[model samples]
Target: MKPAVGAIRRASIYAVVSYGGLVLINNSGLQLPSMWIAYLPMFIGVYVFTQWVDRKF
Candidate 1:
């Protein structure tokens, strides 16, 4: 149950980042390159960082 809760928390964070990025691209006036491209590195970085942190602690 404790580990499940942590998994839920991490999943929520990922969802927020994904949807928030999409919303920003839709609402923001500033022109930019593909929004998904910008977001990919961030998502991957966060995932990798989380794995590293979990292993360390």
Candidate 2:
């Protein structure tokens, strides 16, 4: 697989797992409103960093 594609796939897996865990935690009592907003930058940031890493390493 291309480096970019691999990076994206791994990032996606991470996003899904993290989001699910957060939602589960929220449901259990840590109500954080509009968590998607928090995740937006993180998602982009992770992608950016992963791309940089993929290129650098």
Candidate 3:
């Protein structure tokens, strides 16, 4: 149960951070050759963060 709660917490954090970042980028008027390129780093960062969070708690 603790692990489940921790997982949920981490997921929420990831979702909020990802959404906020996308929103900021969209509003910043920065042009990208491809959106996938932007997503690549975000996904990688979130994955690494999730892994760290899992190990942390």
Candidate 4:
């Protein structure tokens, strides 16, 4: 239950960062497709990686 709760929290943070990254990229003149293809995945991947690291440590 505790690990589940922590996962939910980390996922929420990832959502925020992913959305924020998309917004920033779009505003910076990147096309929607490109933004999703590039920046969004990186942000999500990093977030997941960090969560894995957290659990490991």
TM-score per model over all chains: 0.49, 0.48, 0.68, 0.58
- Candidate 2, clashing residue pairs? none
Give per-residue CA lDDT, model 2, range 1-57, as digits (tens): 687877786676667665775576557653457767666766676667656655654
* Residue 24 displacement (Å), model 2: 0.5
Per-residue lDDT over 1-57 for candidate 1, one digit per residue giving the tens place of the 0 to 100 score: 989977877776667665766676568764666766666776687677666655554
Best-fitting candidate, scored by TM-score: 3
TM-score ranking, best first: 3, 4, 1, 2
By lDDT, the candidates rank as 3, 4, 1, 2
Clashes of each: 0, 0, 0, 0
TM-score of 4: 0.58
lDDT head-to-head 1 vs 2, winner: 1
Q: Give the Å shift of residue 2 in candidate 4.
A: 0.2
- Candidate 2: global Cα-lDDT? 0.64
Local distance difference test values of all predictions, in order: 0.67, 0.64, 0.78, 0.70
Model 1 lDDT on a 0 to 1 scale: 0.67
Worst 10 residues of 4 by lDDT: 31-40
Candidate 3 vs 4: which has more lDDT: 3
Name the candidate that leads on lDDT: 3
Candidate 1 local Cα displacement, residue 29, angstroms: 4.5
Assess the local accuracy of residue 38 in candidate 4 as a C-alpha lDDT between 0 and 100.
76
Could you tell which candidate, 2 or 4, scores higher by TM-score?
A: 4
Deviation of model 4 at 4, angstroms: 1.0
Estimate, for each residue in 1-57, the C-alpha lDDT of model 3 and write its tens digit.
987888798888788777877787678776888976777787788778777776776
